[model samples]
Target: MKGNDHLITAKAPGKLYIAGEYAVVETGYPSIIVALDQFVTVEISRSKSFGSIVSKQYREDSVFWRRQGDQMILDNRDNTFNYIISAIRLTEEYAQTLGRRMAVYDLRVNSDLDSPNGKKYGLGSSAAVTVATVKALCEFYQIPLTKSKLFKLSAIAHLDVQGNGSLGDVAASVYGGWIAYQSFDRNWLMAAHRQQSLTELVDQPWPNLTITQLTPPENLRLIIGWTGSPASTSHLVDKVAISKSRQHETYNQFLIDSKRCLNDLIDGFKNGSLSTIQAGIQKNREILKRLADFSKVQIETPTLKKMCDIAVAHSAAAKSSGAGGGDCGIVVIDKNQNIKSLIKRWEENGITRLSLRVHPVIDLAKETK
Candidate 1:
């Protein structure tokens, strides 16, 4: 794709939240997120035809295409196709503003995330696709969109697809680091603050960490367990927002406790305090239970609770990582524990487990071209 001067390619990966899920929607709370090894890739090439952007999807050796300016169409078959259109439309608008000639292009998008049985692992695959598509368009059209700007643009695209959403997921996918996100009211005051301060916040360098010097921990494992049911994070978040607007004391208390748990986890990671980290996970689970009604009927299921109980029985600290309902759970194992044996035990119980180890946060804008 690179050999063709007119074509451009870019890729961005999905992400998992290390901490701060529902709490991030609050004004003062901060969220921590990291990009996963899994990614979605986009390739864009010039088309000789004018005013005709053609979009394609590639999955499992199958390919399909859709034409631009047609009725707003969404292929129920391909999730990545929706985001490709968003990226192209955003890129085209920006190009128009710069007085650049608009040329039709062919876009090819591929995703590594699995979609079997209509099940998703809640790993931010949609955000990854949006970021990758935007990056490809920025490169292909020679439009200068900074990482933060790209993140903001991708958030708009996300809202177009999902109705309403926090940009934290897209920010994590693009920036690839521990991010502290605060959802400000989209009022003039908050918008002004965002416009004035976002760049500075993103530009600030990550703190130095001693973990980079040590060999990645062999026993440190993350087990992502899926609950077959799916829940809408946007709806849950909006409900919570409405509850907050009504000044519900119970909801406000949950937010406070969530923030406290998140801060403790961040501090634990900083000091390498495994005990504190485990304690924070435990507290976070408790807070989730207290706020059960916010999530409607999607509280952690009996099966997931039993799994967490088993992990705890084995001395492993576990908690739900994303919007609670039935998405996924993250378990952090101790350094001295045998992760393989633990995973085997999980599999015996019909729980799927994936190994994930934490790494130093990478600043993508500075680290990559």
Candidate 2:
């Protein structure tokens, strides 16, 4: 595979939710997300007979696929490669619309978002992989995809497989760095996809969707701690949606409060106020706790509680990351704040501290080529 005359490689970074968890799913509601240094990379090279996909994360379960008219037909029903397969199908369709030639290619995927033992860190691998695949294929076909186009295509592919997600992670993967993101109206996009060309659908402005890069305060220090337990974000989100349907009034208020809290947090970033940012995180944590009690869902486990408490005790702000029934907890402190004791306490309670920094944004002028 390495000896191929032309090999196109692309990597997309993993992400963590800084704030606005359950609320961000709704159209127009915003959340803060940061792309981490870890990534999922995809490599594509010409294949003689048929296209195949191999993922290091999936071990022995490789997928053999071929084109059936305009569709990708996988040899097996293994769901592990659904995200990658969907990306290939959508990107190829888009390429065909632009009169770009399509051909068989062998695709390889590698990820650094999970542990060596295959334990997930809940770092949004699916989103990263989908983004990387779209990026790689666009380059392979010489499509000259922009970052925004890359994001739109990746989101469509991911949603086609997963069926649901706020797609904040998709935005982070495409844009990189810290961003304030609001999800677009998925219903509208689906409707437009049926009526418009793939190229037209991607170029049009998505209703209510916005992604803005944020500049963190100079003194900010983000700390990530893994609880050694993986959580299913889709399952947790499904349960919350069910509870929300039964308790509309309570859920509505949660949305309102969450929007206000995150606004302050975004403002803190704009004003370079570390104290305001910490306060906003503290408030959001309390709001999530109330939401959990009413919905009877455990967004924060006992282990996560211990982690947050330790951070608060040390004068920092902490909360469960993503849809946390388990997995990672995030803490925000001033760079000047002494956190050695806070880390010691977390280690004593069996939490593993993760050393991850923010991935910077890509220059769109250079990236599009």
Candidate 3:
């Protein structure tokens, strides 16, 4: 664990999508993301074996990857390790652009975000792992990585495997903390991928993306409660897309309403207007319910509804966060209020309050040094 130039380690935090889940995937819409203290850590050192980069993770001790003519070839047979392999492939390709070869290193990934009994918390772990892996590999090869560069590389890797994500999670992992982000153009990126010339895209100016770091407004405390389950964000997003295709007017109205609510909330944060913030959160919750009614999807399950109702009874503004069918619900509470009673109430209702803090960093490159 002692310091050495040869041994490189990086940790990236998981994220919570505070607002703008499905809408932010569009080119100009904005989303709010906060990095959590829970993290994925990657540690790398020179490998004992030659001609192969070895990876070790939970239960799968030895998976090796090698390169042949710019293509990364895996020496194992498990889809469980695809994310790691994809990160390695993208890193190797990027290093080759800079006239350096990716080195063979023993890379190990571990996470501290799981529950005591090994259940996932839906805290953007994949994005954190991919970001950490990219950082570890780039450092091992001595290739300087800026925030923009890291985002591009991480997005490319993620896209290659997952196919479609807003990359808001990627942004959160690369640049930690509470941030307002606008999605980049996926079509342009897909074209770059088709050309197999990521170097050009990486070198090009970044899209007109805005990622601003902000502190929680005064006296505002964030309350995160888990429903003791996981919901597939992709599944929910795809379902919404299906609805959007058919219910164009409904989806459009929902967009306008959400955008208005988020703008007011963000402005309130800047101006220190707690009332405006609370109102915006409350209205957004109602809007979400209406969207569920329109789409006929269970966006807020009974458990989430109960959690939000509990928060409201405690004089807090609450809603199910992210693509919520079964996952966490976030409550915006006043710090001055006694939350002990509310916590007990939540527990009695089968809701588990989670301990999370924001991970703050502005520029990824500046922070790496």
Candidate 4:
């Protein structure tokens, strides 16, 4: 088999959910997410000797890996590299199905979402890395890349490692910009994985998954504030998923209200309904709080609550982003209101305001000449 000679590089941005996470995971409801400028980049070029995978932040330990038949055999026992490697293995396997042979190459992964001290920002690093690596490997093997195809491949790789995730982050990374995503059917995915027929999962368009592009009105003001803490989205989601099974009525009402709130907000984004948008944001926050109270999950931590309080004082609506044990909060100021006081109040309360905007996905593989 001829080795891939093209030096391909791909990058994907991290994501922050604006509304409805736990509910999305359970019933495959829609959630709004925005891709950030923070990204994970993977560069693939022909290797001289053997295949190696390296990371920018974790430079201390590098690993040598070989693809045999359909599996990736790595020398290192560290599971930290599983995210990227899982993507590598799946991409190679999928390429083989296209009658394309795999090649040995240097797959270098890098990211800027981490602190200098190696602390994470809870910006969906795993999903970003998985998406970027998958894209890099597919392009390296001369496999055609599409957003839908990329989403399916990336989701399989991520779920193979994490066991469970909503894949909202993966969708945001793949499509970029502001997106409303409905979860893929977990049962269908599990069945396919168990049967070792993941390719069967992507024979056509995803039946249960829905990702739509949406942009906020120009008059609305957006502010992102971080708590300087990384929250485990899976942990918080699991808590709600488990407890919600028993509390049927409460969870059902939450689902109904959550759907309505997001729909109203989406309508507001399409139109210039500032009051409707603000109302929906606050309504969603209250429903999430009620759900948290019933499920015994602290979806909104103390810091997030304080952030929301400050935003409220400034005549803005705020809510905890993502799963939210402790993480960033998104503030949507009605009209073109000033957030200087809101930002100042956040600083006074020790909250960090993160400057993040919608990052449209760029085709780096195509850009490489």
Which candidate number would show the highest lDDT if scored against the true structure? 2
The C-alpha RMSD in Å for every predicted model, in order, reads 5.7, 2.0, 2.5, 2.3
Counting clashing residue pairs in each candidate, in order, gives: 0, 0, 0, 0
Q: Write the per-residue lDDT of candidate 1 for residues 173-257, one digit (tens) a residue.
A: 7766445455443343234434654334224332221011112234455567665556667777676667566657877788788
Q: How many clashes does the backbone of model 4 have?
A: 0
Q: Which of the two candidates, 3 or 4, achieves a greater TM-score against the reference?
A: 4
What is the C-alpha lDDT profile of model 4 across 1-369, one tens digit per residue? 134686678889998888876777854687888899988999988875578888888887788877665566787887478888788878877887788766678888889877667877788999999999988787788777778889999998998888776889998999888888898787877776677655676676655789988877777777888887878887877788788789999889999888888888788767877677788888889989998899999988899999999998888888998888887888888656777788898999989998777787555445433
Query: Relative to the true structure, how large is the alpha-carbon lDDT of every model?
Result: 0.62, 0.92, 0.80, 0.82
Give stretches of model 4 more than 4 Å off.
Answer: 1-3, 67-71, 193-199, 361-369
- Tens-place lDDT per residue, model 3, 1-369, is 223237788888998877776778767677778888888888888764443434333654467666555565667776576677788888887888889854556777788777767687888877888899998888777788888888889888987888776889999998887887888888877876788677888878656567777667778888899999888887888788888899899899888887877787778777877777778778878988888897887888999999999999999998888888888888888889999989999999999999987777745555456
The collision pairs in model 4 are: none
**Candidate 1: misplaced stretches above 4 Å?**
1-4, 50-81, 116-118, 188-220, 239-247, 293-297, 355-369
Model 1 worst lDDT run, 10 consecutive residues: 207-216
Q: What TM-score would you give candidate 2 relative to the actual structure? A: 0.97
CA lDDT of 296 in candidate 2? 90
Give the per-residue Cα lDDT of candidate 4 at 246. 95
**On a 0 to 1 TM-score scale, where does candidate 4 land against the true structure?**
0.94
